[model samples]
Target: MKLKSFLLICFSMFFVVSTVQAATTISISVNGTTVKTDVAPFIENGTTYVPLRSVEQIEGLSIKSWNNKTKTLIISDPSKSMTFRVNNQSQSDSPLIKNNRVMVPIRFIARNFSSDVAWNAYTKTVHVAKINDKEKANLKSEDITESRIAAINIPIISTLKELTAGESSAGYFQLMFPEGESKNFFTIQNGIINHYQVKENAAWLTWSGIIGGNKNTNTFWVTNTDISSEVGQRPTSKDRLFFYNISEHSGQSQHGYISTNGEKTILGSKDMNSLNDLYPIPEEELKH
Candidate 1:
């Protein structure tokens, strides 16, 4: 990578804060359950520090490997492994042990596990979630199959538009999990989506095809601070789209949207137009 581009990436990966929130009511919630610990998480420099050991408490998540000599922690299952080495206490993203508690970047697990992470200021909560179809079996959503749109008094679109990988301004990714059984495509961009409309905004979008391995599904997921909608409800900022499956560790993020742009876009689940809605991930997002 070019020096300039690498510098930009490194800068974006970090954060800075003037006031440290040590006494804040920060806590960790996995799947949907709050992770209990005598040692509560705290915020420093705009990054949340969580008990590294609190990770193991999460049922489905386990330490696949821990090399004490190297101070390396590998939180993994059959699907994913996250590596984080203890850096010097002065380093920004370094892991630290406090009062017999192991602390690391709070967002480390969520980012690596394909789970969505959010930090809410109003309620002072940290949300981490690895959502899936099995958990949402009760709140299931159906496709826009011809019948639904017919009642809306609108003409249906005959065909969806084609998507080309590497063509997106924001990079694209192939999120693979569910033990090699699912491959979801996400083309991320700093814009929101509206059904049958072409308006771009500042919020970022994580567009995908067939969320949770659902066949022929179009999901226009948002990753920002606005709480656009309520859970399992119509468009709002509070929604999130989890793409992987889980059985043992069902820890999800605290309920809130984290953003730098102060914008909220409604997450997609139900179809917008019978034919015209947000496009799906391009076929090229898949690995060869």
Candidate 2:
């Protein structure tokens, strides 16, 4: 009995350490304005987790209880009239509650609801722009665009920004860059890239079954190089496909020439047979 109890305790401890990372205070901004919430936001597995419900904010979001504590969270947007399971049992990414507070996946919510989300790596803040927030987000970016980094341009597409820019701006996207021929490109063996909202927090999943291949996630945060000391391992800035200026608008991208690290494989919309087809970001959306 004692041996069984010890094994159970070990499993519990492993679960906690694997799923949870260092808690950092996050700055929440919606439509370019700071928002105060009843409960602050936190990060897990490199994704930004927000309270399932905000106080007098996000009027469009509404939810029902967790089915008598089965640990399943359901949310709906009557404004958008969409619903989905929080745990997404079939998927690796799942919403969780800590400290008696339930947290929803902000990135997942933004993607389905037509929203844009950006992060300020230096200040460690988050920017969320809903359908209405887009105009405000654009204006906010304009205000700081001169002082902050401008939207990066993709060398191959010339018309589009780096794929990473969309994720940086949208805050949640699963991007993939397959191995193509490029002397400068990084992360050679092309496969789908599972991006952790934050680059440094990805290593925690090395032992987990969920990770597809973060090695293709060649994007790195050059400005906050030391930010991962809390996570013990430093994120590699080498072999990243793109690097942008580390400004509030740029989400603390590395300040320098925009990286053409992995554009060797031309990205297209209609032709999935081309190089690798990751999720497509609207062309106009790249400007902001």
Candidate 2 has an lDDT of 0.35
Write candidate 1's Cα lDDT for 1-288 as tens digits: 222232232122111111213444675655434577678787766678887776665435776777788888788855767777887463446676666666877676656655556664533556565544333331122332122111111111101221222222232121111111111112122221212210110111122122221211223334222322212222323322322111111221111112323232223233222112222322112221
Q: Rate the local accuracy (lDDT) of all candidates.
A: 0.37, 0.35
Off by over 4 Å in 2: 1-24, 64-66, 79-93, 133-288
Measured against the true structure, the TM-scores of the candidates, in listed sequence, are 0.40, 0.35
Residue 282, candidate 1: how far off, in angstroms?
32
RMSD of each: 18.7, 18.1
Angstrom error of the Cα, residue 288, model 2: value is: 17
Which lDDT value does model 1 have at 54? 69
Residue-level lDDT for 204 in candidate 1: 14
